[model samples]
Target: MARLTVPLVLFGALIALLLVGRVTSVQAQDIEPRAFSNAPIGVNFLIAGYGYTRGGLAFDSSVPVTDPQLETSSAVLGYARVIDLWGQSGKVDVMVPYSWLSGTAESAGQPIERIVDGFADPRFRLSVNLLGAPALTLEEFRDYKQDLIVGASLQVSAPWGQYDNSRVVNLGTNRWWFKPEIGVSKAVGPWTFELAGAVTLYTENQDFLNGGTRAQEPLYSLQGHVIRGFRSGVWASLDVTHFTGGRTTINDTLNNDLQRNWRLGGTLALPVDAHNSIKLYASSGVAARTGNNFDLIGIAWQYRWGGGL
Candidate 1:
């Protein structure tokens, strides 16, 4: 155990330093592109952003609500680091979000409304390139071109946000979730194509609303992206996603709410300088499962350093 102390301390310090730098990301219904791309070891990222949504805001689609007319404004900070893992390229990252939500909905045939603000669940991820990417320095990374890369990642969302047992709509779920995913990225000329599949498993929320216990089945998701890159350090992508199968049970009573939803979005990233970049993104639900219809638009700024840069 003593032999592991130094490495653990170093890793903790690394994450602390990056968190002090600030960063950003989205959590639910995630549709991120280039998530598995390789980067030079030791490179660090700082991202900060804000997002606005109209219609609904439920971490799980089966929130037992109907005809929701809601809006959410979210602010997030995130950080990421590239590391060398067993001669392969890997990354560790985290994102935290704070949200102000205002909404109205019908529950059990009663009209309800709430205006609330608080921190949302934070997410952390660890990813490693399994094939077609090797650990490299900045110099080696400059001359490298990607063809086919396969990667795997695990993402976790912790129950660190505010939750009210009396309110049906809140910023937190009072539960934990894990997502294990595998992805493939292929670069073709100036275009890149990527696909990912994941399953999100949830733990029971013991202190659910009305002092009842709540449990959910796993949710499965698949997403695809088509990206175009230019020589001017600007890139864009079209994204689509489908997720299904999150049936909820409350107090031994099974709810008829099962989720099958689809969303479409796009992202544009423009590099302003060697250390600064800007990103614009938008997504809309094409098919929603009850309390899951929403439209989102967001913009973020990113800063990169280290890795001898």
Candidate 2:
């Protein structure tokens, strides 16, 4: 029975690991599962991963590029720790990513292309399960079973990536962004159902497109997941997400590029042993209103320690 609990605890790391593969800011569309899951207190996780994304640049609609397609390869390093918040289960995690991209498109009826490589923005997140999950030690967790859990999270993107105002195709946004989310998770037998909602807000980019100031409206998103868990501690999930409302204004001039998009994704997590796990994931854009779409695939390896294991 103790062996059954090992992989389950590491499921939460998939949120940060899979997220590192997506686009940035308003173009960032992702599907995550097991976000509200629980783990023993004092557990630490180290993860290293690689991903490849193929899709349109999905630039802020204000840009006049057309028929844009890009292929990007990225790598990320991440860390997470489970904490105790007044008996409630809590987590804090961070990820840093680097990427290389090559693409081509047409702007104003003229052909354009770019190939670049550099560090992308880094993200940090804090999450807390407000109900159902408890902060238990490894010994106490052996008997724990999830019922219904409610959780909240806040994630921030720092503008510390490689960016140049002179180039339209750079690896960084040179702006800060924030996302606040709330979610619920319910377990029935070996199946879990999860739903979450979030809003992403962006700060002004004073140096966009060579000293051009850019601002964007808030983007709202909703996601759902269905998961199946096996006794061997392996799990698989089906995920879907929809998002809308991210129009941009450059130099105080508003643009009419409101967005509506849908995405589908899947995840498979396998625990090799008590301390190591591997995850494979893929996502694709199903529908897009403003020409923003992408198909992404990635893999990650996680190692766990502490928690008195």
Candidate 3:
């Protein structure tokens, strides 16, 4: 009937845009998994990754600490493109990261250590889909299918990376930041569900460290995902995130570091053919009050190509 209801509504909108292309996050109370996705119109993708983290940071007894530790490792690269817009369906992505960090802190008790590497803040994103999706190709997106869809995105963070005014712990955070998001997805039978919300905005860092001046406020997030699909292409996911406020200030004083966090993660994707794929992930910090109490692991490799262009 109607060609089997348009391939079951384009296969439930392609499994809700493959669970919103697996949302991604970095720092500032991060947690991500499929932010809302659906693809077709041109297509292209590439990704590479490695990550490791272990942390503990709680500093706010006015200004001075007693015990803190952090360890980090990273390497990441990404690219994506899919477009149409006007008729809807759009995408764009970029990410670049490189880091290595080591830390230990204590003030009056004495014991300070620091090690650093380079590159960190670099990200860019833009997404659109605004309801049920459209703009197809790749042979009309192989027939199309959907149940619900909605999307919006904007992400940016670029301070170039590797900054030092004399270090306090630097990888980068010299300034600039952005985030604005909204997402929704749904499917059934083979499962898919998602939700998203975000707010992160900051800019101000006038040297800070020896020169001093920094500021922050605004960071609020919420995320969720549940995905499942199998047979050949494979998929799996279960994730959660929550975040609240960001408080900081330097020369003007005030460094409450306010943040209420919660996170939990999981992901698995495997294909290795028809354009290749492989992904695995992990996340932790079930709850935290200040910030940074981490555990993470990652792996990634993905490739795909322009469909018709």
Candidate 4:
């Protein structure tokens, strides 16, 4: 029985880690499952993935002349470690992404095309369980069962990507952005429900196109997911998200690029063994008032190691 409990606890922790890999930042609306999870401390995970996206960029009427289209492909790599903080379960992770993009747009009644390839801004996240989850060892975790969990996280994007002062559109945002989020999850039987809310704040870009300062208002986002677990360490999720209010200004001139978007997506995870898992997901914009109207598909591989410390 003791030996059986160890493998069960380890498998549960790995499933939670694989769910985290599904929440990539490749799109504006990130889909997350099991945001407030209970896993034993001192576990580490490594993830690698690829994503493809095709969409149209919606521009303000003051700048563009016609329809614009964009297609992008990216490679993602990340590392995560679970620890104990203040007697509670906590995690810290980092992600780096590189992308190649090509697009066409019409300006001044003429069609223009451009291609760019470079690294995008990297992201770091720290999350802590605030309620209903405590730091536990492997043996102690064996008897634990999840109920209601509340968690909080802070995610930051560093402005270290490829940026060109001369280009109007580049792979990088050229500014720092961060989001503070709170999440709650409840489990009943083999199903879990999760909801999370966040607001994204951006810093000024001093080197905007043609040497102008660029600023944006705060963006508000809400996300929800319904997840179901199956036999053999398999899980699936249905997810949705909405975002609004990110009006941009360049040199004090307001742009009509406020975001009011809704998206829907789903994810599936299959476990090959105790240490390896695969994730597949796809999402599309159901409604878009501004920004990009795109569809994205991604697949990831996760390898986990380490046990309780």
Q: After best superposition, candidate 2 residue 126: deviation in angstroms?
A: 0.5
Per-residue lDDT over 110-167 for candidate 2, one digit per residue giving the tens place of the 0 to 100 score: 7879898888888888989999999988778768898999999999989988888976
lDDT scores of the candidates, listed in order: 0.81, 0.77, 0.70, 0.77
Cα lDDT tens digits, model 4, 222-298, are 99999897756778899999988888888998877788888898988887666778888888889978645778889
TM-scores for all predictions: 0.91, 0.90, 0.32, 0.90
Q: What C-alpha lDDT, on a 0 to 100 scale, does residue 21 get in candidate 3?
A: 39
What stretches of model 4 exceed 4 Å from their correct place? 1-19, 56-66, 107-110
In candidate 4, position 24 carries an lDDT of: 58
- What is residue 143's positional error in candidate 1, in angstroms? 1.2
What residue pairs clash in candidate 2, if any at all? none
Give per-residue CA lDDT, model 1, range 10-123, as digits (tens). Answer: 333322222221234454788888878877789888888988888876454667778889888889888899999999999898998899989899888999998999899998
Per-residue lDDT for 1-309 in model 3, tens only? Answer: 987765544443343335333333345555566665666777777777777777753111112344567777788777777788889888888878787878886644678787888777788888898888887877786667667888898888888888887666677777888888888888787787888889988887888777888788887888888988764456788988888777777788877667788888888876654555667777787886754567777777766677663
Model 1 bad stretches (over 4 Å): 1-24
User: Quick one: best TM-score, which candidate?
Assistant: 1
Clashes of each: 5, 0, 16, 0
Candidate 3 ranges beyond 4 A from true positions: 10-12, 19-31, 36-38, 42-136, 143-176, 179-201, 205-214, 217-226, 230-236, 240-247, 254-260, 265-285, 291-309
